[model samples]
Structure formats: structure tokens, C-alpha cells
Target: MTTRMAAPMSVTTESLAPSRSTETACFHCGLPVPPDAPYAVVIDGRRQPMCCHGCEAVAEAIVAAGLTDFYHHRTTLSRRPEDLIPESLRGLELYDRPDLQKSFVRVDGEHTREAALILEGIVCAACVWLNERHVNALPGVLEFRVNYSTHRARLCWDERQI
Candidate 1:
């Protein structure tokens, strides 16, 4: 039936939209990055692309210099922020006792004693943080610092707290 054949539909090809170029940020300077950048620094513990190794080295130098504000800001943009312990609690005691049944040996004054605690279940920074935090919260603690790499906490405390 060649009577009224419907005209053939013409198919049109749709072009794809261009993708947006990703902007790279420098780890140390917070500057715009290029595609061919080589070295990158850890910005707030996150890796970032850098223009060159010198720039990355400079950034690392800044971090090593104890200027962490920049890194902190950059890290906040992409990662969870860390909770730093209060400076007041940096050097504090948890507990100490001169005559306690189960306690570390003393080498100094009764009020000031050094104890090696066999910390159990300490594996990460969080564990160190928790143990140090709890230990420092004690009334008589004078100083407490944990060596996570060694899984131990070195504590100095006033005997009264025990």
C-alpha cells in the first residue's frame, strides 16, 4: 500500500557538555594548582597537589616550624578536625601513691613520683587521647604523656590523688 507512508523521522545527534575543569589547591600556600604539578604537601593531613617539590618542601618547613594554622584551615575544608587537649592539661598528673599496695616505685619526693603504667587496649591516637585525658583529669596529676608508638603512658602524679 504505497498510499500514505509516514515520512521517516530524522534523528539528531546531541553533543555532550564539556566537563568543568577541576581546580587544584596547593597544600602549603592555598594557591591555585596546575595539571602538571609535581610535588604536593599534606594539608592538614590531606594530600594536595603542588607546583614543584620546592613549594612542597617550603610548606613542610612551615609545618615543621610549628605554624599549623594554615594546615588546620585547609584540613578543615576536607576532613574532620582533631580535638587538641587543653594546654593546661598538657603536663598534669592522674594518680600517685607512696604507700599504695599496687603502685610504681618511687625515686623522688613522695608528692612527685614516676610510674610505668601497663596501659591495656591502647592502639591509636584516640586511645592515647582517652587515657591521657582521663589520667590528666585526676586532681593530683602533674604530667602525663602517652607514647602511642610504644603503647605506653608515662605518668607523674602527686601521691594525694591516689
Candidate 2:
């Protein structure tokens, strides 16, 4: 089965013409922000195109944390969206914690649980394929799916192997 979600909001433009592809530097990651990108965020008073929602969210978080100086001092393009996720947030094991699981997970059968996640670094169909492949290869993962349009994942797995 396929599911669809609403696209993210975009700032309006005066012209009704289709946007032409142009290579503009991403304000957050310093990579080439394609002309037709669907996600964008305002940073330091200017609106900038973000390659994906992950980049936009990360940029927003950085600016909100008052760490804007990192952009000025950085010498290279930003790391993969997955790598940019802070160490504190990488505790996947936390899902096993009862308190946390109560909020985002649902019990299916005796040994299985289902959950949804918003994945980062998924910018294309290839990314969706790779993520699904890698995650499905895990020991107890019974099902793994990635939605390229929304960058959302649906997963089912055995609690014991998790």
C-alpha cells in the first residue's frame, strides 16, 4: 500500500512562472541548493533553499541554539544529515525504554512492535532504497519502508532482537 502526505509549505513568489534550475549555495550546508527544492528556512534574516527538510530543521536548530558562528568558521560542506544528528539524539536504544515507547510505538503481536520515524538524509529515491535495504538487513527487522516524498519511515521488528 502507498500513502501520501502533504508537501511542506513554501514562501510565495510574485511570478507565476515555473522556477528555473539554478545552482545556489545552501545557506545551511554550503552545498548546491537546487532551484526546485521544496524545503527552505530563514536564517540570519535571509531565506535560503535547503536540500531537504532535514537540512532545514538542522539549520533552524543551530540558529535557535545561537551557534550561528559554526557556519562562518566551517571550511567544508556539511556532513551527511545522519552524521549531523547530535550524539545525544542518536540513542536508538531509547526506543526500548518503556516510557519513550509509549509515545511513538504500537504493539502488534506478542513479539513485534511498529513505529514511525522521520528519517534524515533522504533526498532522493536512491536514498529511500538504501535506507530500506540497510534497515531491512538488520537481524530482527520484519518490515522497513521509506517514503521519499515525506522522508518518513515505517518499521516493524522483534523487541527481543532490538
Candidate 3:
């Protein structure tokens, strides 16, 4: 008896995934979202597709911080998730929002603000010192101090300069 073999078939994400329009992009990084892409984050009470786990993590952090406006004010798509940042720096721009500043900043003068901040992941004196030094070096930073025991940071700055 002679046996017949079937032809080889190739499959891509588009083929395996459900159908979607070509215009759909990742809400976080502007990458094209594969039809089958499963990673997503809820933003503004709607599901937003993510390009990868890194983007998803960053989005979740933003949403958790009540900075969903970060999505609204962004001028450019974020960098590739792998290239984003240290956990602490990922959402720096979100702080520009007045709502976020309200949580930590006290108006000390017409142009100055003092922010009481909780420094996360600071486990040692060196970490506190490093943070203090760097923050103090920033332009417009009038003062910066970190308490090793409490990981609380008090920062004074000229809002116009930084």
C-alpha cells in the first residue's frame, strides 16, 4: 500500500489569533498588537492592550497611582518595555499632574513647593544617601533629605526650575 503525506502548513500570530483590524496598536508602547495578544491593562474603565509584560507592569503602576491622566498627556509613545526604566522612575512624568502633586506637595510660596515623599525600596542608609545626593543635585532642588529609619523624603524645589 502507498501512503500519501499532507503538505506542511505555516502559522503566524495573525493566523492563530482572532481577527482584528490592522489599526490596533498597543496602548502603552504604540507597537502593533497581535490579534492574539493576551496581555492587557484596564485604563479608564476599559481594557487596553499591551505590547508585552513590561508595558503591562508599567501601565498597572500608573493606574494604581491614580495617574491615568498619564495616558492623556503623553506626547510620545513610551520606549520599549524592556528599555523603560527602574521601577521608581517608570512613571516620573505622571508627577507633573496637579492631582498627583496634591498628594505629596505643599505650597510653600508662589513658585515653590515642598513635597513629602515615601521612598520605596530604600532598605539601607546608602540608598537614602544616594537618593538625597541625586535629588539635591537636580536643578531647582532647594533641599532634599531622606530619613533612613522611615524612608520618608522631604524635598523643596522651585516649581519653575524643575
Which residue segments of model 1 deviate by more than 4 Å? 1-103
Ranking according to lDDT, highest score first: 3, 2, 1
Task: For model 3, give the 10-residue run with minimal summed lDDT.
Answer: 8-17
Question: What tens digits encode model 1's per-residue C-alpha lDDT throughout 1-162?
Answer: 474433323211111111334655554444456777778765445565665555666567665665645443332222211225566665544332336624665555856777776666676798888678867877888878998887667788776675
Cα misplacement distance, residue 57 of candidate 1 (Å): 44
Pairing residues by index, what is the TM-score of model 1?
A: 0.35
Predicted model with the maximum lDDT: 3
Give candidate 2's total backbone clashes: 0
Runs in model 3 with CA error above 4 Å? 1-89
lDDT of 3 by residue, 1-162 (tens): 995433323212333233456656777777777677788998877788877776887789888877776676566677774574688777788988999889889999899999898877998888888788867977899999998888888999998998
In candidate 2, the residue pairs with backbone N, CA or C atoms under 3 Å apart (3 or more residues apart, or in different chains) clash, namely none
Angstrom error of the Cα, residue 78, model 3: value is 20
What are the TM-scores, per candidate, against the unseen true structure?
0.35, 0.45, 0.45
Tell me the tens digit of each residue's lDDT in model 2 across 28-135. Answer: 655666678887777556686777776887788777776665554555567767886789889877677989988888999898999988888877898888678868
Error of 3 at 46 (Å): 54
Off by over 4 Å in 2: 1-86, 90-92
